[model samples]
Every structure is written in C-alpha cells, then in structure tokens.
Target: MTNNTPRVALVTGGSGGIGRTVVERLARDGMAVGVHYAGNKARAEETVAAVQALGGRAVAVSGDVADEHAMSDAFDTVEREFGGLDVVVNTAGIMLLSPIATLDLDDLDRMHRTNIRGTFVVSQQAARRVRRGGAIINFSTSVTRLQFPAYGAYAASKGAVEAMTLILARELRGKDITVNAVAPGPTATELFLDGKDQAAIDTLAKAAPLERLGTPEDVAESVAFLAGPARWVNGQVLYTNGGVA
Candidate 1:
C-alpha cells in the first residue's frame, strides 16, 4: 500500500516444478511472494534463495494445504512477513495413475486430500485475505478433457478444482477478486514424467499438437498473467494445452 509494487502473493507447492516456476515469475514481477510447501523444507528454502538471488522478496512457509489451520497459518505468515496479501496461486496437486477397478482407497484419498481439499482450504483463505483487485488462481489440468486411461482419479481431482474456482468467482461478485483455474497440458516435470519409459513419453509427446511436453515455465507465464493483468478474466478455466484437447 506504500510503494509502486502492486501487492504480495503466495504460491502453494512452491518447492515443486510448476509451483516453483510460478513463485519465481511472480517474485520477478515485483510482488513479495510466500512460497508454501509440504515437507520439502530444503527445496522450499532453495526456492526462496533463488528468488532472493534475483532481487525478489520471498520466504518459504511449510504447511499442508489441505489442513484448515495450517493454511490459515500460511496466510498469517505471509501477511506478517510480506506486509499483506493480494494474490494467490495454487499449484499444489498430486497425480497417481491407476485403473478405477484397481485404485486403492488410500491413494484416492491422498489425491483428494492434496488436490481437492488442499485447493479448497487455500482458496478459502485467499478469499478472506486478498485485497480488492486481488486474484486467486487455481491449478487444473488438460487431462480432464483429454480423459486419458488410468487418469480418472487425477482428472476427477482437478475437476473438483475447476468447479470450486467457478463458484468462488461468482460468490465473490462484489469483492473485486477474480477467481480462475489454469489447466496445463503435459509438462516435462519429474512428477509428470516419472517412471515412464522413453517410448511412453514419446507417445505422449506426439499426442500434443505441439509434439512435445510442456515446461513448468510455460505454465508459469499463464499463471502470471491471470494473477497480474487479467483482472477481467474471472470465473473461467483457461486450458494451456497446445491445442491438444
């Protein structure tokens, strides 16, 4: 509220691939950033260090995004350290592939807890704290539309996110906060490609119209636009797939 800088923002899952890229881009854009992580202390710290190295203000805060109290504390830390809140980018998600018939309840629950519940907790917190003209950006995936085999659970989880974002934007009608979701195509992160053979990866590459995997940075740019300048784009799901689906 005192400088040319717009406002502070928080990026959940800040230690992971897409999340880390989002934190860096937002920080570079002159917003104080809170990098939230779950159990990846070293990586989160490294993310903070990298942002600092780039002359950006940032800090790492650890908490499970699914827990209400923990998410509350995360925002408390962000407001306390960075002055106040303005934007939120939720990139925390888990993807476990399994046939619906063979899917373990435990795996299903974990994905829901982190991807669906986590998104709710964090978005709720953002709704309460972010200032007027602030933004809330949630992560979805192009997989929901692609409907690839063995990705039912993952797609379902992101589907929940898309639903949440749509309603939250309508619910916040008079508040000046724009809520939206970004669904990226297959990205070249360890999490996205782990355990896949070269042949499998090559097949996936061919599936995309671009004939390659997406990079975390590619997705981050979309996030940056939603959080910074795309104020009118509320209550929409922007799928950043290379015309795949």
Candidate 2:
C-alpha cells in the first residue's frame, strides 16, 4: 500500500460473467490482476488479452476453487508474478435450483462444494497471504433475503459466506485487512439468465426499485470501492441489488 508500488489482485472465476467484469474493474483501478478460471482456459486467456489491450497488467491462473493445493498455487503464482497480493475476490460459483422438497442431494452437495467450500479455500489462502491494507471479497446473493422458492440451497451456501465474511473480518482485526461479501440481485449475467424465462426475469427485475436487471458493471463498482477506498466497510454484506431489500 505504499505510494510507488501498484497493488495486485487475484479474482477467482475471473473468466465468467461478473468475474470478468471484476477483473477489468480492478485492472482499471491500477492493480495488476490475476484472472483465475476453473476450466475455461480460452476464456481466461481472452480476459487476460482484454486486460492487456487496455494496457493493464494481467495473468491467467486456473484452479478448482475448492482444491486447497490448487488455490495455494494460484495465490503463489499471483504473488510471485505481481510481487505481492493485496486483494482476493472469490467470484467463482454455481447455482442449481430446485424446491427443497424435491431438491437433489447430489445437486446440493455439488453447489456447496463450489460455493461454500470454494469460498473457504480461497479465503483461507487470502487470509494467510494477502498484505496489510488488503481486502478479501466473496460473492453472495440477495436471494438469501428474498427467499425465492427453489433457491434454498443457493441461499444456504451464501448465508454461510456472509457468516464467514464477518468472522474473517473480525479475525483479521489489527491486520488492516477487510473481509466482506457482495450480494448481487438479479444481475443480467449468463448465469442468471440461463434457463430463466423472460417473465421470470422481468418479475425479478421489477422486484428491485431500479426496475431492471443489474449489469455486471453495476456490481463491479461496488467491488472496486471495497478493493480500493472502502477501508472502514468491513465484516458486512453490501447488497448490490438496487434497493431490493
């Protein structure tokens, strides 16, 4: 956090919809970025290329977010490449929806492995490695509050994330590191749009006071604030849902 040296950020799931925007936003904030992808090497590379196109420094690192060793290596790569780590953003997640009465336990387990365990793994590394003045941002969802049917499993996982974010922030006290979660509502991303009918999307969009789906850029702005100047905003969930409770 010195004056001359630039900050470094590693964004997990950086190849996807919101993750890609987070990468670009952090890079635009003058932080060298590590774009982490799970399986999409080409998309990850394209993100890196886009960052480079903007004349920003970036590298692509791949790993399963739930794998401890892979994430450790990823942290190492980002730190080694950029000289140090200042921000870690966990954006890699999966959502499979079903009513709790008939939900597949297999689906629940799979989603938990990625959303819950994945946040923990990445967070453990960030807690251990991120420099002072750093921030760790995890993704949650406003559905935890809205309690929409069929999102029980997803909400449960993100509820765990909100809990972890507060606990991690308290644990990092005096370290000057902030831990928080960004819970976005009805963002217009492939993940949210996939398999959703137009009526369903419109209903959710109008549920917010903004009366429209949130753009990835809208969420990225919240992230950029947390990563840069929101020093006092710790151990909290900032709902980037356009006033949707």
Candidate 3:
C-alpha cells in the first residue's frame, strides 16, 4: 500500500545513524517526515535538508523520547505542520557495553530509560494517535540473539522491546496498526564503532556472514518495508543481521 498523499512520519533520533537513513527513506517514499532529535538541532536540520533536497517534506523536531511531555510536544509539532501522523519509528536508544559484573547501575538505569521506557512511552502515543492504516516501528539489536558478553545490559533492555512489540500488536489487533521492531547486527555507525581500533574494526566487520558490517541503509531497508506496504506483517522482530546471529 504505497501512499502519495504525503503521510506524516516521526523518526526518533533522526540525526543518528539508522535513524537518519529511516528518515531519508521515508521522506523519499512521499511521507512528510518528522526529523526528531534529543539535542542535536544542527544534525537534525541537515537530515531535513537532505530530505528536502530529494523533493520531500521534512521538519526537525526536538524531544526526549523517555518524557511524555516532550514526545507529545514533538508529535504536536508534526501534526501542526504536516497535518497528522501515519507512521512512527522509535529509533532513539543507547548502548553501554560492560561485563555484567562490572556494569554500572547508573548506566544500566540510563539505558533502560531510553531503550525500554522511551520505546514504551513513544509507542503508547503511537498506539493512540497513528492513523488507521499506520505503522508503529520499534528498534532492537541483534545482540539479544548473539548473547555477546558485554552486551547483557543492552540486550536485556531490547528484550523488553521485543516483548512489548508483540503484546502491543495483540493489544492493537483491531486498529489496523502494525507494531514491529528491526534488530540489526554490528553496523558501521558512530555508535557501533566508538571505541574500536583499525584491526579490531576490521575483525568485527568480517564476523558477519556477508563478510562485512551492516550499514544504516541496510537496516533502514527493513524498517522502510515494515513502515510502508507489508501491511500483513505485525509484532515481528525482523533481524537484519546479515545472518550473523
């Protein structure tokens, strides 16, 4: 079900790696995108500019996905400017890797706030507000299936996302709104490469079946599929991991 009437889409963390790709792709697909960011106005504006350069409508909105007030405000901005929402992509998340025994409670709490609570808060709003045939997409990570050593905390949080997505789909069974998540493996994003060295990066890059790390555009392709068309798919956690886990 392709749309040309300019559907509105809100992509949280729109300035980030996969988020930016999702924003750009949805915009190109004829959706008026909401480039949402927590504190990066310049980057968000750049995403919006790129979308505009592609002959699409986009606007940058600021909000904390964990905060209801902020999320509602961002949604209001989208509705006011583009009319109403048809798609919402919850892509705002944080990853702090540490052995479970060495994990900091503060870091764990912070990750939980953004990855779990934030996804829930924004999804709740999407459940109530998205148009009849809209899509509510969430973000997860492939580490949940890989069971990587230092990723326990992050994976735990995304596990919550996996569970919430399935239940949310059942809860919204009559609404025609599909709730789903895309879990990508190691991607070539700043967030995914923050502390790695050259050799380390090369080793990790070749760990996947495809012999290279995933790309933001690769993950965005799965998200875009679930967001538009793919109406029969719901509550699925599609792992776009290059067959790595």
Against the true structure, what is each candidate's TM-score? 0.97, 0.98, 0.96
For TM-score, the strongest prediction is: 2
**How well does model 2 score by local distance difference test?**
0.94
Please write out the lDDT profile of model 1 over residues 107-189, one tens digit for every residue. Answer: 99999999999999999999999988899999999989998999999999999999999999999989999999999988899
Q: Give the per-residue lDDT digits (tens) of candidate 3, residues 44-63.
A: 99999999998899999998
The residue pairs found clashing in candidate 2 are none
Model 3 alpha-carbon miss at residue 122, Å = 0.3
Q: Of the pair 2 and 3, which is ahead by TM-score?
A: 2
Q: Whole-model Cα lDDT per candidate?
A: 0.91, 0.94, 0.92
- Model 2, position 79: C-alpha lDDT score: 88
Q: Enumerate clash totals for all models, in the order shown.
A: 0, 0, 0
Residue 157 in candidate 1, Cα distance off native in Å: 1.2
Off by over 4 Å in 3: 1-4
